[model samples]
Target: MLERWSRGLKGLGNWTAGVMDAFYGALGTPGKYLQDFLNGSWLGHPLHPVLTDVVVGGFTMLIILDLVSLIFGANFRDPSLIILGLTTLAGIATILSGLTDFKDTATGDERNVTTLHGYTNVASILIYAIAFFVRLGGSETTGQILAIIGYLVISVGAFIGGHVVFKYGYMVNHNAFSRGRRAKEFTPIMPAVELAENTPTKAALGPTALVLVRRGDVVYALKETCSHAGGPLSEGQLQGGAIVCPWHASHFRLSDGAVVHGPAHTRQVAYRARIQAGQVEVEGPVG
Candidate 1:
C-alpha cells in the first residue's frame, strides 16, 4: 500500500514539477536566501522538524481541551480556539520551511515521499483551519468534531514525516558512519607535487575516497562524497575558501569541512593530510 501510494505521489509530482519550479524560480535570489535561512544553514540542523513540534504540540493541547469539555461539560471553547489560532500561525511558518526543503528534492522516490508528506500535512492544516473558524462562530460541537478529525489526519501526517526521515534518510548526513580508516597511521596515496594548487584531486586512501586540495605549503583533505546526498565533492568547484557540491550546491569549508552553506546541516568528513617523503599521505580524521 505504501509503495502504491508512493507511486501515485510520484505521478502527481511529475505532473506538477514544472509549475512548482517556475513558481519557486520566480522568487529568485530572495527565495533562495529564504530557503537557506529556513533550512537552518547557520543552526546546523533542519528547522522545519523543530518548528513542527510547536504546531503539533498546540493542536495536541486542543485535543486535550476537547476531552476536558466533553468530560466536565465545561465550556473550554475560548482556550481551545486561542490554542488553535496560535498553532495555525505556527503551522504556516512550518509549511514555509518544509516547502523550502521540498524544493531541493530531486525527481525520484525521495521527491515522491516528500511530496506525499507535504500534501498530508497541508490537508491536516486545512482541517484545523476549518475547525478554528467553526469554533469562532460558537459551534462548539461541530468544532470539536472537526478538531478530532484534524488531529487524526495530522497523526498520519506525522507518521509519514517520520518515514521521510528514517525510511528514506532525508536530510541526514550521507557519511555519518564514515570515519576515515580503522588504522590511525597516515597512508600515502600519491605524490604531493602532483596535486595542483587550488584544484580538487581525487585520491583513495585504503577504504576512503578523498578530495585533496593543495595551497602552497598546506594541503587539505576531505571525504570525496558529499555529506549531503553523497554528491561527489571531487567534481565540485572550489570557490573562495569553500567547496560547493555540484549536486545540491551545498558548501563546506576547505579548512575544517564545516558547513558554510546548506541544504546540508552536517559537516563533511575532514581528514588530515601530511607530506611524507614528497607523497601526500592521508591520516585519520581531523582532530
Candidate 2:
C-alpha cells in the first residue's frame, strides 16, 4: 500500500525538477562549498539526519509535556514553548540541508521518491508552524491538539524519509562497500588501444564494472557507478583529468578517484591500469 502511494508521488516530480534545477544551478563555487558544509561532507555523513533527531526529540518532549499538563493539571507551558521554538529552528536547518542534497538527485524514479519525501516534510513543517502560533496565543487546548497533529504528520514524513535511505539509497556512497576488497592481482579486461584518450570506456573485471579513461600511456580506472546516486560513469564526460557523472555532474579525479566536486562526499574506487601484452590490465587499488 505504501509502495503504491510512494510511486504515485512521481506525478509531481516534473514540476519539482523544473523549479529546483534553477535554484541548484545558481549556487556557484562558494554556494557549493556552503552546500557541502551543510550536508556534512566534513563529518563524513549527512547532517540532515543528525539535525532531524533534535527536531523529533523536541516535538516528542513537547507532546509529553502537553500530556502531563493535561493529566496532572500542571503548568508545563514554559518548557513546551521553549522546545517548540528550538524544534522550529532545527527543522528549518534540516530543510535547508535536505534541499541542498535533493537538488543533486538524478532524475527518474529516485527523483520522484525524493520529491515525495521532501514535500511531505514540508507539510509537517507547516503543521508545526501553525502549532507554534497557536501555542504563542496562550490557547493551551488548541495548541496541544495542533502539536499532537504536527507530530503525527512528521512521523509520517519520518517513515518516508527512512524509505528514501533504506529503499532508494539517498546520500549514500554507492561504492563504499567494495573499495579495498577487490583481489590484489592484475586482470586484463580489454586491449589498451580500445580505450581512447580523454573518453570514458566501460570494462568489467571479475564482478566489478569500471570506467577507464586513457591519457597517453596511462589508463585511469574508477568504479563505473557514480558515488552519488549511482549514476553511470562510463556515460559521463572526462574533463581536466576528472570524470563527470552525467546525471548530477559529480566530478572525480581519474588519478585517485578523489571527489573534485560534489554532492558526492566519498571518493570513488581508483585502480591503475598498465598495458600487459598489448592489453589493458588493472591491478587492485590505486595509491
Candidate 3:
C-alpha cells in the first residue's frame, strides 16, 4: 500500500516530463540542438548537474538570506518574494534538463536510482511550490515555518541526486581507472605475431572481448562493446584513426577513446598495449 502510494505522485512527474518532451520536440532541429547542448558535448560531461547546482545553490542562498533576515532584522528588511519566484523558474528548468539526460540512460541500476532522484526532486518542487504560494499571499509566521520545512525537503532531494551521480556513476559507462589497462594489459590467447597488419582482430582478455588493431608500430585497443548501446564496434568499419559503430555510426578515436562522431559523446575507454613474452598485453589508465 505504501509503495503504491509513494508511486502515486509519480504521475505528476511523468505528466510534467511528457509536457517538456512535447515542448522540446516541437522545437524540431532546435530541440535536438538543445539536447546536444545540454548533453555537454562541449563540456565532456552531462550538463544537467551543472544547471541543477546553479538552481539549488541559488535557493540555498535565498534560505541563508532569509535566516539572516530573521536573525539580524534591519539589515535584511522587507521580503521581496523574488527569491521564491526565481526558485520556481530555476527548479522547473533543472527538472527539464534532468529529464533529457535521464532518457538517454540505459535500463539498469543507474536508471532506477536516477528515477528515484527525479521523483525526490519533484516532491521537493511540490513542497517549494506550496511554501512559495503561502509567502506570496502574506509573509505570515506560518509562511516562514513552511519555508523552513521546504528548505529541508530540497536538501534531501539534493542528497538523492548526489547519490545517483556520485555513488552510482549514472553517466559513466565503463571502468575508467587502472591506467587504462583493464582492456589493454591483457595476455591475449591469440598470437600477436599472427595479427593481420593494419587490421582489427578479435581477442579475449579474461572474460571481456576486445578489438586489437595495429598500425605499423602503434597498436590500439578498445572494448569490443560500444559504450552507447553495446553494439559490436570490433566488427565496425575502421576509418582514419577511429572505429565507427555499425549500429549507430558512433565513432571513437583509437588513440584515445574520444568520440569523434555524434549520438555517442562519451569516450570508449582506450587501453595502452604492448608485446610482452611473444603475447599481446593490454591495460588501461589507472583511475
Highest lDDT: which candidate? Answer: 1
Give TM-scores for every candidate, taking all chains together and pairing residue i with residue i.
0.92, 0.85, 0.64
| Residue 208, model 3: Cα distance from true site in angstroms | 5.8
Task: Please provide, for model 3 over 48-92, each residue's C-alpha lDDT reduced to its tens digit, 9 standing for 90 to 100.
Answer: 778778778767776787777778764432343677667767888
Identify the candidate with maximal TM-score: 1
Candidates 2 and 3, the one with greater TM-score: 2
**Residue 90 C-alpha lDDT in model 2:** 89
Write the residue-wise lDDT of candidate 1 on 184-267 in tens digits. Answer: 787788998899998998988887889999988788899998887889999999989999999878889998999887878888
Candidate 2: misplaced stretches above 4 Å? 6-8, 72-74, 104-109, 176-181, 275-279
Ranking by lDDT: 1, 2, 3
**Tens-digit lDDT track for model 2 on 1-287?**
45556577766766666655676568767776776677676566788899989989889999888888889999988888889888988898888888878877666667777777788888888888888888899887888888888888889888888887887678988876766437588888898778787789998987788999888888888989888778899999877979988987878888889877777878888887877788888988765
lDDT of 2: 0.81
Quality of model 3 by C-alpha lDDT = 0.68
Q: What's the CA error at residue 235 for candidate 3, in Å? A: 6.8
Compared with the true structure, model 3 gives a TM-score of 0.64
Instruction: Tell me the whole-model lDDT of each prediction, alpha carbons only.
Output: 0.83, 0.81, 0.68
lDDT measured at residue 52 in model 3 versus the true structure, 0 to 100: 77
Per-prediction count of colliding residue pairs? 0, 0, 19
Pull out the clashing pairs in model 1.
none
